[model samples]
Target: MVYPKTGSLIVRDGREMTYTHIQANQTPSRSVCFFFPGASYSFDRPYLYYSTMLFLSKQIDLVHVNAAYGKDIPDFETSSFAKRSAWISEDVKTVVFQVLDQQEYEHVFFLGKSLGTVPIACSLLKEPRFSRSSAILLTPLLREELVVADLLALEQNVFLVSGTADPHYHQPTLERIITSKPNIHRYLPQNAKHSLDIGLQVDLSLQVLQSIMDELGCFLDKSLDI
Candidate 1:
């Protein structure tokens, strides 16, 4: 089947998939995003990924990628969370290449949440194409290798953001370690957390996200018209 030049679609198992694509007027803007969903959920889920749409739509055209859990969903019931993220990264890498081809995006940007950060980071390290664009990491899970890989990134513009009172992790402390090591712009929201919405209140998270998106939009190619 021929792909349309406008909206984005995913053909998984030959099924024409309707993705959560938000396309503004087709201007010369960077129209692609690598939305790496957290391990606990997929792209279509509201709480994890969808919750950030309000802030994202204003910045650029979007495509929310579902997490690939290999042959089955990752569970504490079997493998560790870290392991699942690794497996999903391979699948997500495949998806990214497919989308980049189908979407015909000029400028590429990355958006990864929680566990999604690691594998995507690794993929960028291995392949050179993804490194051409900026990376906006949301509440990432970092390891020694990820830190090492980050410094090796070909893409200079990196945005690292998280909350002060993150409910599930202590990544905020690690921010300082990586923040100055590279060309990273850091934002630890006044009181944000793992999810964009922390403390069960999304208002603060949403505000911070909007602020970040505004900055990103400013840098987007002016050709993608307002």
Candidate 2:
């Protein structure tokens, strides 16, 4: 498959955000997936690449939101947590609105990893359009009340893939939350870390990622009923 095209746009707040657009080349499913990376990660990472390929293989277009910390925006590291979180949420909402306004997508899906899940969760409360959409949350920081509340509020299907050893959430708490929501499909891979890397061996990490991709493929097929 061809690589995605890079594009940049200025949001309403005058903060510039970069995104990658990948058009569907085969089946033209008319579905789109908006990807949000972790705090320090970008769309070029291996995980994002794997996800983009998965969606493309299904003929789903991709819109990957690059991290806003490195450009003209204020450094997230130095800013207060509340301020940074708000900014991230606003940025994501703006991008989503822009994309939807410009395209004619029949189905919208949000794929978020780690800190990225915060904005996806927040958008569900702030934007009514997202309430009807699906979500794939990788290593979601469920410790936040907003995340938990949004997850509870979502009536659509949600696929949550996390590690058994993720530090951001307690296993028992995660289990309880999953048990409370029948719409959520949970996957907990053993000995995996927050990034879903099994260990220091690169080969083993890639193998684990393949397993994740297989799981994600099944979830996508079920969620989209394809």
Candidate 3:
């Protein structure tokens, strides 16, 4: 299952950022999506892999950001939360801006999971240029005050998913977000873990995945007015 892609690189903040640009087949696409993977989650992960196919099927170009910290950037692991957030935000912005500068898009979107949600919540959501863009936050760090605060302030459409059993799923924070922002659509799977998988319940996990993809399809269609 090899999809056509163009590998590219960019230097940001003294670091070389590598990414893969996957264009949709057939007609040119007016929409583009940037994907930010979690610290340990790569683009080929189930959620992301299927989502990538979904976007391309809809004729939306995809940019997968390959970002990793810790070993490569030793100080990142020791940095304060604020500093870490800033670092992630900058890296994401550089890739997004560089891509956008070369072409124009009628619609821009972002899909991030876990650690990837940090940049979308803290920076991209607040940027004036992306005011009309939509975002999909998969298993966001709801326990983080900054992330939740920004989510509450979100004005554009966003799809957020998490599991109650996941450590990062904060009921109080999610409640506040729901109470504050009507633009954010949320999905919570009971007993599902961080990967949205039911422990030892392979069938149930697959069911959850189906539901997520279905909901995401509807969200994308609605957002694009398809």
The TM-score leader among the candidates is: 3
lDDT of each: 0.56, 0.77, 0.88
Give the higher-TM-score candidate: 2 or 3: 3
Better model by TM-score, 1 or 3?
3
Flag regions of model 2 displaced more than 4 Å: 26-29, 70-75, 78-82
Better of 1 and 2 by TM-score: 2
The whole-model C-alpha lDDT of candidate 1 against the native structure comes to 0.56
Residue by residue across 1-226, what tens digits does model 2's lDDT show? 6446777778646767888777876433578999999876667777777898899888888888885564455466677656677878877777777777877788888998888888776664347665567888988887776567677776777888888767865666677666788878888887788878877867877887898899899988886773
In model 2, the clashing pairs are: none
In candidate 3, which residue pairs clash?
Answer: none
Q: Write the per-residue lDDT of candidate 3 for residues 32-138, one digit (tens) a residue.
A: 99999998889988999999989988889888988776566778888888889999999878888988887688999999999999999899989999899999999
Off by over 4 Å in 3: 1-3, 10-13
Error of 2 at 52 (Å): 0.6
Q: What is the descending lDDT order?
A: 3, 2, 1
**CA RMSD of all predictions:** 5.6, 2.6, 1.7
Error of 2 at 221 (Å): 0.9
